[model samples]
Target chain A: MSNKKVTGKVWKFGSDINTDLVIPNFAIYMTREEQPAHCFVANRPGWVDEVQPGDILIAGTNFGVGSGRPIGDVFVDLGVFAVVAESFNGLGLRNCVNAGLASLPCKGILDAFDEGDIAEVDWGTGEVRNLTKGTTLTGQALPPEIQSIVEEGGVMAKLKKEGFVS
Target chain B: MGMNAIEKILAKRSGQTVVKPGDVVMVDVDTAVSFDYGKPNIKKIHNPDMLVLLHDHVVPSPTLSAANGAKSLREFVAKFGIKNYFPVGRHGISHVLVAEEGLALPGNILVNGDSHTCSSGALNCLARGMGPSEMTYIICKGKTWYIVGPTTKIVLEGTLSEGVFPRDVIHYIAGQHGDFAGRNLEWYGPGLEAIGMDGRLTMATISAELSVEFSLFPYDKVLADYLDGRAKKPFEPSFPDDDAVYDQVITINLSEIEPQVVLPNKVAWNSKPISEVVGKHVDQAFIGSCANGRLSDFAIAAQVVKGKKVAEGTRFIITPGSQEVMRQAVKAGYVETLLEAGAVVTNSTCGACYGGHMGLLADGEVCITASTRNFKGRMGSAEAEIYMGSPATVAASAIAGVIADPRVALKVKELA
Candidate 1:
């Protein structure tokens, strides 16, 4: 596992944030760079414009709840460094790792901090520290293989390096 | 001391005799399915014969981009010599068609790039959805890794009374237990004998809504009979050991169940018996999806609304699960009966369910759908209301022009 740290502004959201809310089906046909603008269009319009680079998204249970459309790429395109939710759908969690997004599932993560507060994460140990609130929460660490995939910048990048795909 | 059904299937596929929760292993895939959404950038596939390609989502290509995507997949299919390809005419919702075509067999490992791929677990296989990225890896390797999670044992006792269906069964399960995120679910009991393959598939498909990794049914004579001629491959059935271990067990008496409706939006723990939501006005009655769309659904729906006309101002739409299902439905005379009842039958696709193409609900309209989901903006306008139920309930509502129970409507039809 890669030992690295990231600190970013926090964007708090509620539970059951599904794929349709992250990026609708129609936006799938759009170019990669053009897709981030439509992220969270259902609930948070203009979110793309407001979210700065290196922001961290925090949410309640069942985060990324619906269809598995690889929302991690959207998070990466939006410049979100990491996602820490109370829990995640199994399918969504795999999608996050495949897209190389650093994510942690920490219980009581919903109450750790308010939106816009700064939070720091240690990818090696799966620990999240809310700098603004001076609080820390333990999270499930990524398995060794999964961490390797994340460090390599995603499954596709690894596959490309291994000459599995073009 | 022993393995459950899912454990046995996973273990055998991974070349292990025993596996428990938290065991991670790479498994050979029996079948890997993809739809029009796949962006094929692969240099080589490990096994083309094991792959199943089809065009169902965005059927008829509502947009120019979708049409272009379909064309690309066609090229990819031909380039790889993929023989198990289903084009638009024979295309269907991948979940429904995969099981219908018998690509999934008992004791096999089936993977698809769609969330509802869990539906095939009803065939008593270790089946679940894998994302496109993982699917890409599978295409290159013909194998994928699975981290086993704790499996919950669901016991269904007794037979379901008339007017109740797998839709209602699932709704009742979700209403009481809520979502099982990061977990697995296995179904068995006396109820298995009473439910058919379609009913078991419905329960498994809707289990995706509960966010289970895999939802499966135990193999029995019921499944054996269904797979007699439909099995496209040789296979062995998997079953839990006598002393099988489970994380938890929940029992439901199917005989006690009645007509049910899942409220608009998320369905986890948000459903009620039909009596509570009666008379809720609905403009559209939809009866189709991989979950509820089948020849059986059409048969029951046609019977429920046989001689009755669709209520004035209420639109009833029926989309079969697949072209094969549509053909079987037509031969059964269900299609003609529905059309004579004033229901508009559309080509088989994932239409209206995901709100991709046909039968979109207008703003401020209310719809009662037998499809998988009822979330806001799922079928059309965010302002529209969606109530989910069985085909019988939805068909009965089409005649009543309101969200009415199927039992009452069936009684009315008999008296007529």
Candidate 2:
């Protein structure tokens, strides 16, 4: 597997980072690149400019518990590198995986990473390497089926690749 | 190793040799649902032979524009060959109509676009909620892959104490189980039949908040008798054999279960002694929804509203949940009874369960309702607190102008 690591600034948050905060529906009609600018607009007003292409989002437990509309579309629109959290609400995890957005559940994420620190995220090996801290945190290895979906891009692409449709 | 009831049932349906906790297998869907809002999605698929569309939530009360909207939905139903379309002025809530129509058979697997799809598990089906996207996938593809989960058998025995309705039983279980109890909740034992269909639906409907996979009541004579006079149809009958497996079987004796209430913010916040909120006056009292808006539910409500007017400051709304239920309620004079009691009987639509439409509460107001989910902003503003209880409790609370224990208010007779 290619070690195509994603290096960018880091953003942090606590538990219950609902989809409403991540990708509000009002901005859904816009393209993905335009969405990151509005991501966390409700909670952290200026998250868009602070985050670079490969920046990582770290959150606490019970993340993604609200309505399931906004997360998938917004994350895809914004091109977030990866989402690392203590745990995820079932629907949020499902939506993220289906959308081909990388997510890792690692314990003590709050104490491990800080804001604007470049981090390397590798999907193949399921590892998040903190370059500044000189520390590495491993996460639950993605199941082969899910990994395949991510490699194919997202559920729609995976469906096409599987010949589900033309 | 043996699998639990949930695992065994799913394994059997999916044609799997064995089902472990994490085994993912595609299972056949027993019931599929669509509604008025889903009409747009249904038009895209253009397949009506495989869907149940009901317009119980948004009937567009009296205005001509709203009437036109309802008519447009009906025209769509006609364009598609959907055999099960409950148009406004015809059907109640989807969950209630599913039961009344004899659609939710025992041991069947049901899938609906709505989150409260688990309500049909009252008929012993393995029901799970899905969103429009997932449902669209299911419509295009007939089956869904699911991870087999262990079953948690919640066996409640002994007679229910006075005024302890089925909603109380479920709320109590949710309180004890906490959130994420979505593993499985199966109700068994002699007491199962005593709860009847409406009560069983109430017990199953609220399982959504608990993250329960599904709730089941084993098929018995009560259910069979209810089905006898109704139109007959072919159904697959299933149950756990004597040697069938189960992860854990917990027995709850009902004699000790007094009137229970779920406090604000979470349906699982089960509290003891309803008397604690005796003086907490409510601004609104809603006694309907997919949770507890059946004919039997209203009969219980009418018992409390027969002669007394609603609390002067309270707005009591009663929704029967289905067209047939409304007819039955009207025929039985319960509707009149509620009207005399100063209650506004609204159409059989889903209102107040969410802030979406109808019966919205103002800021800082409190409501004692029979609907599910008391989460902040669920019914209205986050500032408005909601307490969930049985229909009997909601009715009694409406009469007393505050949260009340129906057992004390009605002096309900002891269970047989």
Candidate 3:
């Protein structure tokens, strides 16, 4: 796994933030490069204009709960560094990992950070440090296999490197 | 050590004598399904014979972008020499068509790019969804690794009350137990005898709503009958050992279940009795999706709306799950009854279920749908509220312009 630390501005959301809120089906037909512009447009208009590269998203329990649309492609295209949630939907978690977006599941992390707070996440050590608040929280680390896939920049790249794909 | 159905399927495919939860093993895929959205990402095929390409998400090309995507999928199918491709007009919702076409069989390990792929698990297959990248890998390698999940045994007893369908039973399960997130559920008991293949498919289709990794029914006479002439291959039925250990066991008495509805925003958390939500105004009523868009759903809706007209202000839409289902409904006169009642009967697609096309709700509208989910902005506007129910309830609500009880409507029909 990568030992590098990731620091970004936090975008906090409430519980049960589903995939439709992240990327609705209307925008699903757009090419990967063009779809990021419509991310979170339904709930938070002008979100794409405000969000910068390497930003971190944090949410309450049952985050990304909905159809297994590849919403993670938008995250990857927009250069989202990682997602931190109290819990996650199983299919959404898999999509995020496959897209090379790090997903950290931490209990009570929503209570510790607010919107726009700068946070630093260390994947190898499982530490989520709220740099703005001067506090830190320990999150559950991904399994070694999953972490390695993310570190290698998604399953496609890993498979290609291993000669599984052309 | 005893093994469950999933374990047996995985072991057989991987050529292993035994398998258990958390064991990572690479197994051969019996069937791999891809839709319009997923087909664009697949670069190569490790086994052309194992892939099934379906065009149903944006059937008839709702927009220019969707048409372009469909074109890309068609090109991919041609380039790969894939023989199992189903174009628009010939295809329906991937989940429904896969089963109808006999792509998934008992004891097979099936994977699709859509979360609703779990619907095929009702036939006693180990079916589940994988992400796009993982799907690509599977297509390239014809094999993928899985960390077997601990199985939960859910036993259903007694029989469902009239007008109370399998959708109600699933809603009750989700209402009582928050979400089966991260768990694999195995269903069995006398209730299986009561709920046949169609009802079991309804139950398995919503497994994604509860975040279940996989939902499976045991191999029984119902499944055998459903697969009689449809199966691509003749296979032996697989079952869990008599002493197989389960992580958890949940038993529900089906006789106690009433017609149910899940309120807006959260599909699983909020569940109220049908009486409580009845008479609530609804602007739209939909009866289709991979979950409940079959011949049975249409028959129930047609029965409810036989002699009645759709409410003045409501837009009622009916979409069959597949072209085959559509033809069957037409042959049975259900299509004519639905059309005569002022309902818009559209082609087989996942229309309006994901707000993709065919009946999007405007701002502040309220809709009662027989589809799977009701998350914010799922059907249309985020400000709009959505209620989930059975097709019978939706049809009744369409005629009354409010959430009405299906039993009352059926009673009125019988009296008339």
Best by TM-score: 1
TM-score of chain A considered alone, across all candidate predictions: 0.94, 0.84, 0.93
Model 2 C-alpha lDDT per residue in residues B78-174, reported as the tens digit of each score: 7666687876567778788877887777667777766577787777677777644556556656666665556777787888987788888777776
**Candidate 3, after superposition: displacement of residue B124 in Å?**
1.1
Candidate 1 versus the native: TM-score? 0.97
RMSD of 1: 1.6
> How do all the candidates rank in terms of lDDT, highest first?
1, 3, 2
lDDT for each candidate structure: 0.87, 0.71, 0.86
Q: Which stretches of candidate 1 lie over 4 Å from their true place?
A: none
DockQ, cand. 1 = 0.65
Worst 10 residues of 3 chain B by lDDT: B36-45
DockQ of model 3, rounded to 2 decimals: 0.55
Model 3, position B319, has a per-residue lDDT of 92
- List the lowest-lDDT window of 10 residues for candidate 3 chain A: A24-33
Each candidate's fnat, listed in order, reads 0.52, 0.00, 0.60
What C-alpha root-mean-square deviation, in Å, does candidate 2 show against the real structure? 4.6
Which residue ranges in model 2 land beyond 4 Å of their true spot? A1-71, A74-143, A146-166, B38-48, B61-80, B229-232, B269-273, B412-416
